[model samples]
Target: MENTRNVLDFFQKIVKEEPDVSAAVAAIRTLMNILENFGDGETLRGLSEELRKATEEMKKAECSITSVQSGCELFQRFITLTSLEQSNFKDCKEIMKKRGEIFLRKLQEARPKIARLGAPFILDGHKILTHSKSRVVLQTLVEAAVISKKRFHVFITESHPDLSGVAMRDELLKHSIGSTLILDSAMGYVMESVDLVLVGAEGVVESGGIINKIGTYTMALCAKEMHKPFYVLAESFKFVRLYPLNQRDLPQELKFSSTIIESNHSNLLDQHPQVDYTPPGYLTLLFTDLGILTPSAVSDELIKLYL
Candidate 1:
């Protein structure tokens, strides 16, 4: 229980100190810290169990668990792979720590690579529409403007319940990028004006679909109907092994924020869902560190990693 509290505090502290850092990265870093300080002579199974408990604690502390869940899953996979190569438990722990550091370094390098890949698509005078706040998306915009010197306007949805889009708009304006903040309901009204839709994912599921901010699916539907291309900017680590046929197909814990899940309210209708699944069909392409991949390619990547 104490370790779990420490995990939660460290996770929250990282988020508070670095507002741009994704929860997934913070979760990974927190786990790495646990790996470093984990007591000597503990069995690999014991360490894995401890890590699982810490992950659950962090999940309960956050409004959205997609990133935390995915990060833990990937980290656990690293442990599994390391254990296969080493017989000594201590050697396996050391190897995992070294590999974990490398993995984190790669993740840090991913955004810049993705920015370069995504920048070409931001042509001069293109009117881009983005939902919510994504560090990768923001960096790509900055890359297009600062590095490529492309002139463009951005329309951001006022991602409600959190108003994260407001923050995104402010950040873009800080970079001297022209932007307009619109209501979530106004996506359709702005669809004709938007040349393309760019969004960030909390989790890119196996079916090439995405689990993201609640309104992403609606925005994708709007883009599809308007015949506008919808692009997603996400890192490779954001991918998860899950297939959701629809919203209801999502796991219960993945649907609501910690607050909603812990709420005493007997009626679920009173609570708003934290995230939604956007099917692969609605996505034109995914801008990832791996490359520009069509939706179908996501499963191929997952197969190589998991299978």
Candidate 2:
């Protein structure tokens, strides 16, 4: 329990400096670990209360440090933290649904600016390509489609192992939005005809690199080769400070998952891959809730937040 509290405190310190999804997630995960490891009902309740207070403090700090759009991202982070810390599974699901709603609201608020100033202008019948599933990007496109009063064709990559793009396709279909699901390998072939590429990041480092679901870096490489515009939609909180120390030491964390190591057969081991890193230069623009930033600008942004 002491070790768990120490980890939680470490995450909280990071959150105080960089109020992004990564830090918020770390905090939430640490809290969840405490609950999972120490199964005392009263203690769990006390930790939950403490986490709730921390979340509120994080929010107040975020609003003070960033713009309204950034504030929205902070709110989403809080909602995510709250949802994860919920003791009841049913309540967690309900909170997740509400979190999605809050995310949608934030995306809606930033749509006009993102369409006009963030991404390149799309012609009347332009097709936009996207990889994986991003609620933020999806909501942005939906808002664009509605504002344009015309169909905006979207090509979505069927993210493998997860196939989250399937969910993206279904959501688009329900909204009567035009969309096509393509194999992840087909991204390069389809790049030439697509107007722009939009992706979401799980984390963005001060060095301008980003961490996302597997296949994002490949897409960015393709976009770079094709001279196509590739944009990342992420909140500033995702920005991390990753500097090497003493030329011999570097910060690293091991993410262990049974899902990755244990499979039905050894032959099928390579089938399920998770996580990839996208270098910053390949990204043309990062559309944050704060505003648009070039990949080069990420370091400066992080400095402002960290220093």
Candidate 3:
């Protein structure tokens, strides 16, 4: 049980990495290390049980779609290890190590491919608006601006309570990309001038909608109202089996209780939500490692990968 808790803690800790994918990747590497340290059958069972517990723990912690999906992916690999032992393959450690490598390589290879595929949509002179920060979104913008020389201005919402948008603005500046930060409520005010909307997803549900930062739905609604195309830049791993008809169906982990107000203003300090779902109709396309996908095509992709 102790080891199980440690495994869960390790996954949750690494998930705090700036880009959600980096956090997922870090957790995968740490899991690899954990597997590498286990050489015998008896302790391996403990680790295997711990892996199952870790996945459950992830659900409670509200890990992002990629992390939870990757946990499932890892569990599949664990099944392979057990199968190998039954087949009398004695070098179990070596087999597990190789499996981990294949999985890690698959994840590492996805980021750049997604960026490259998504970059072309950011044409010259396009003023793109994004809510919250996403490493994939940032990388796509950078790829378009730097390597492709696509000159454009980026407008970001100051994703409140966390202000992850500030980090995004700074990152854009670091890459020599131009960006402007705006207050969350000012989205509609600026919507008319924006050519497109680009945002990252915590999870892309089976309904062809995305679960992203709290303001994403509002931003999408505004974009939809203005006839502006809203694009979601995400990897396939962020796709999940959930089909939420409304916000309440989402897991509790997606919400946060920040002490936004304190002391004298104690009564005003209500909990803040961290994410919300944007229906498929609000999005124009999803740029993923699987290529440019229509909102409705998300389910097909999920079926292709998981089934």
Candidate 4:
């Protein structure tokens, strides 16, 4: 139950500074750290059950899609470690520790590669529109400006309900990149002149679609209408096997609240979903750690990973 609580709390706590992949990596690290502190055989067995419970809890919640996928990966890693040469208790602990170290190292390596691989898309003299918040997207833009020495303007929508895009805008400016902040409603109005649309994903499904902040799908539609090249910058780890056919198939959390709306009605916020699904058709390409891939190529990559 305690591990269950930790998993529940982790899923509920949204760290704005970290994107879905970052948060997931942090969660797995935390879990591994906790296990490392208690290395006895009985404790390991107990932790195994607790970790499984935690993974199931994540599955049941409105977790970031990367959290769901990473949680599963961490559990599988634990299982693999347990299956290793268990001739000695100390050796088993060593294996688990080494596995954790390797996982962390891989996660660290993927982030920068994602930035460098996607930064090329941010050419000079182009206006890029992005919504919500994505650390990877910010890093990509910053890399283009600082490392690549390319000058570009970034237009960010003030992602509503939380206004995370304002943070993105500020971060871009801090990196000495040109940026502008606009309201969520101004996506169409602001995107008319945008040469490219670079967005980040909470999860990239096997079907090549992406799950992101609520306004992303709309922004993607607007970008498509404007004939702008819309790109998604995602680490390969954020890709999930789940394929949602439409927004309705998404597990959207709705809270009934009228506090934000100065209205006579009380249930105005009842149907507000924090995230939505953007179809693959709206996407121009997915710049991933594997390579720049068309939306339809997502399933092929997943198959390759599994094989």
- Top lDDT hit: 1
Compose the digit string of candidate 3's lDDT tens values, residues 1-307: 2466677677666766544455456556656757666646555566666555655555545445444654466435543644455443336656777777877777777778989988888899999999888899998998999899999999999999789899999999999898899999999999999999989887788889988888999999999999999988877767777898887787654443222322324443256667788899999999888889999999998777665
**Number of the candidate with higher lDDT, 1 or 2:** 1
Best by TM-score: 1
Task: Please give the lDDT score for candidate 1.
Answer: 0.89
- Sort every candidate by lDDT, greatest first: 1, 3, 4, 2
lDDT of each: 0.89, 0.62, 0.76, 0.74
Let me know the TM-score candidate 1 reaches against the reference structure.
0.97
Global CA lDDT of candidate 2, please?
0.62
Q: Candidate 4: where is the Cα deviation over 4 Å?
A: 1-3, 6-21, 43-46, 56-90, 252-269
Tens-place lDDT per residue, model 1, 1-307, is 3568888999899988998788888988988989888876888878888889888888876645887888788877865775557877788888888888988998899899999999999999999999999899999999999889999999999999899999999999999999999999999999998899999999999999999999999999999999999999998888887899999999878888666766734657777888999999999999999899999999999777664
Where's the lowest-lDDT run of ten residues in candidate 3? 256-265
Scored against the true structure, residue 72 in model 3 reaches a CA lDDT of: 62
Q: Residue 154 CA error for candidate 4 (Å)? A: 0.7
**Pairwise TM-score winner, candidates 1 and 4:** 1
The residue-level lDDT of candidate 1 at 196 comes to: 93
Q: Relative to the unseen true structure, what is the C-alpha lDDT of residue 21 in candidate 3, on a scale of 0 to 100?
A: 54
